[model samples]
Target: MNEMKTDTIETIKRVLAEVRKNPDLAAAMTPSTDIVNDIGLDSLQMITFILSLEDAFSLEIDFETFDFDHLASIAKLSDYIAGRMKEHV
Candidate 1:
């Protein structure tokens, strides 16, 4: 049920908009926007975002050794998710 199979950025944005409860942020977000620092996703929101993202993208995130490195920005997160999705496929 991947809504945007090859468009993880948009998919991520859609998920973020839902998690943030702010539709305007989706429109305002660029690939360069920092999700952690700028978007200010706290612990609970981050958990919700991760869960929602896994559901939305239909994949599980390996949190065993996962770091917040991917959360640095949207583009990086998109790249990470795209890579992870590829691995999932």
Candidate 2:
């Protein structure tokens, strides 16, 4: 894989770790977990999680352009982040 893909994977792992720090939240997450339904992440928590991910990756996500509901699974989230990062390159 290329560096961008590697970075995307790392960012996803980091986001998962941050989300998993909460016991109640951690129990619901899996690679295929749905952020909204399975994890029960509220809007505030979702924003916070995305901000944390942005800080960790040093990338800006156009929040206005994103559909939060689609960011359900880790793979989907990773793909989104990767796409955003590519735009900055």
Best by TM-score: 1
lDDT of candidate 1 over 49-73, digit per residue (tens): 9999899889888886357889988
lDDT of each residue in 1-89, candidate 2, tens digit only: 57766666556655655765654544345557666666666777777888888888788878687886557776678778777878888
Superposition TM-score, candidate 2 onto the true structure: 0.69
What is the lDDT for 60 in model 2? 86
Question: For model 1, what is the alpha-carbon lDDT of residue 33?
Answer: 84
Q: Highest lDDT: which candidate? A: 1
Q: After superposition, how far is residue 13 of candidate 2 from its true place, in Å?
A: 4.4
Q: List pairs with backbone clashes in candidate 1.
A: none
lDDT of each: 0.84, 0.69
TM-score of each: 0.87, 0.69
Alpha-carbon RMSD, candidate 2: 3.3
